[model samples]
Target: MFSKSKINDPVTGKETDAPRPSAPQAPASSGAPAPKGSDFKASAPKVKPPASTLSADLHVTGNMKTTGDIQVEGTVEGDIRAHLLTIGESATIKGEVIADDVVINGRIVGRVRGLKVRLTSTARVEGDIIHKTIAIESGAHFEGSVQRQDDPLNPGAKNPPSPKANPGS
Candidate 1:
């Protein structure tokens, strides 16, 4: 009997065990030769992962950064950077926030920088906000100046005025 082994393929989502190939065959006189074993595999498109969440019982004391999304229901004492950040009604953040999208429903004690920023009715912000676009609900309590920029997430960038798409467009 020939040898066999299992290979978990992510593209096919299967665990397959096929018999190993026999001894090597004579090389073909082609520019590129065929592989000796089973070598064909498909590439799958990457899927976006679920947002990471910090529960209300958690309290973080250092900076947090991620390319993915985050839902915070706890307290954070340092800066946070993410692709998308959601602050729950019971959450509290004590440092700067930089993200592509920011949805605030709780309290923030520092500056907020985002491409799009939304302050819900439960939001309480005490620092300036730098965003490409912003929306504040009627009941939101905000004690901060708001500024618009083409790129607000880049802390060190001396942002110049960038043309924004008109609402009608």
Candidate 2:
């Protein structure tokens, strides 16, 4: 059975006793308010950008460069450059890593240069680290030199000369 039901217009705050039409009606004028729920339906959908990930069973032999974030759960034999880099516990890297933020929970056999570097408890690193700031957890294993630099991301920057010792002191 078909029956007509009175409905209230959200924009105009008026009640209409007319029967609802099966088809959508065009706007009468350009200044007319939109129908109820029309604003939500007309709005664009929100979407998030995807992050690059290397799976545990995969291996990469070439350099990787990205302006976005990267998560590595596999082995990499080449250099990596990104905005943010995360190394999983089961991952292994054999080359240089350059990023703004680098979190290592795996094994690294090459140099690491970043503005901020963190080595988790399970991390094992065998190469030098050049960073503006760095943190090593209690259980982390490191077998290389660690240097602090004012600009760790710039490889061509020269370090300031140390102060000379006085002979009469």
Candidate 3:
């Protein structure tokens, strides 16, 4: 009953069709049918998001966790877990750090755990480091023990079970 309606064109003062037919959509893939309302785009590549930055004057007292990258230029008193964590030259962290990649150019007093960890020449670390791979530049002040593991991100799991999700904000 509501299929046909005349829309007046304001510019030309002419009648126009109100209901327009939608364009036909091709299947997302050539082989298997994609689920309805699937918005995945194969051609549009996903880019790595920019790191969340904490300014030099800011101070955080609680835990921080994310699946994305984080760059700290301030002070954090609690533990941090991220995909990639970068400590700026002026940053100072008092708790443990866990990430896939950890780059420290500042000071950290707690344990560091990562798949890859790097300490720049200006970095100062006082806690032990557990990493699959680690690099320390010359003049880096580190007083901690270092241990290498094949899967440093997971501390004690021998056989691969379901991955543990880190709870965080």
Candidate 4:
């Protein structure tokens, strides 16, 4: 009484015998069993993290080059090469500022070459400031021109105010 090794039931054309592969595979997380020599290198090799150092409320969207040190409290439209730039007080720059050390407490419309510039009275500049050392803290709202960029052999000797008059005329 041992009949087994020839089964066939193509939807009831019936004929059976032959089935045994010791079926049991359900544990590799529910579909079981497969772990005895997977060379498990003690788990710890899944790293991907290195792109964070833009603090001061950061809201930049394009064109920003840094060599180290950047602090701007939101709003940037493009063009900012940093080596040390800090314009926080709800910062807002529209473009162009090559830094070496700049500190303005908000609002710049463009053009500011720094070597050392500080305009903090809730500053609001509208362009043009080539610095070598400048500080305006009397309710600052400067409209440009404060050049004394360390005398490059006297480039027209410190006489600013004539880009078309009105610098205390």
Give the per-residue lDDT digits (tens) of candidate 4, residues 39-71: 544445877444334555667867788676677
Worst 10 residues of 1 by lDDT: 20-29
* lDDT (10s digit) by residue, model 1, range 1-169: 2233233343443423232222211122222454668563333468999999999999999999999999999999999999999999999999999999999999999999999999999999999999999999999999989988887988777665435745455
- Error at 1, model 4, angstroms: 77
Model 4 bad stretches (over 4 Å): 1-67, 75-82, 86-113, 116-142, 151-169
CA deviation > 4 Å runs, candidate 3 = 1-44, 157-169
RMSD of 4: 18.9
Model 2 residue pairs with clashes: none
TM-score between model 1 and native: 0.71
- Relative to the unseen true structure, what is the Cα RMSD of model 3? 9.9
The worst-scoring run of ten residues by lDDT in candidate 2 lies at 22-31
Residue 35, candidate 3: C-alpha displacement in angstroms: 19
Alpha-carbon deviation at 48 in model 1, angstroms: 0.8
Measured with C-alpha atoms, the lDDT of residue 33 in candidate 1 is 50
lDDT of 3 by residue, 1-169 (tens): 1233233334444333333322112332533455679975545587988999999999999999999999999999999999999999999999999999999999999999999999999999999999989999999999989988777777683434435654451
Name the runs in model 2 displaced over 4 angstroms. 1-48, 161-169
Predicted candidate 2 versus true structure: per-residue lDDT over 52-145, tens digit per residue: 9999999999999998999999999999999999999999999999999999999999999999999999999999999999999999999999
Count of backbone collisions within predicted model 4: 11
Candidate 1 segments whose C-alpha is farther than 4 A from its true place: 1-42, 161-169
Scored by TM-score, the top model is 1
Clashing pairs in 1: none
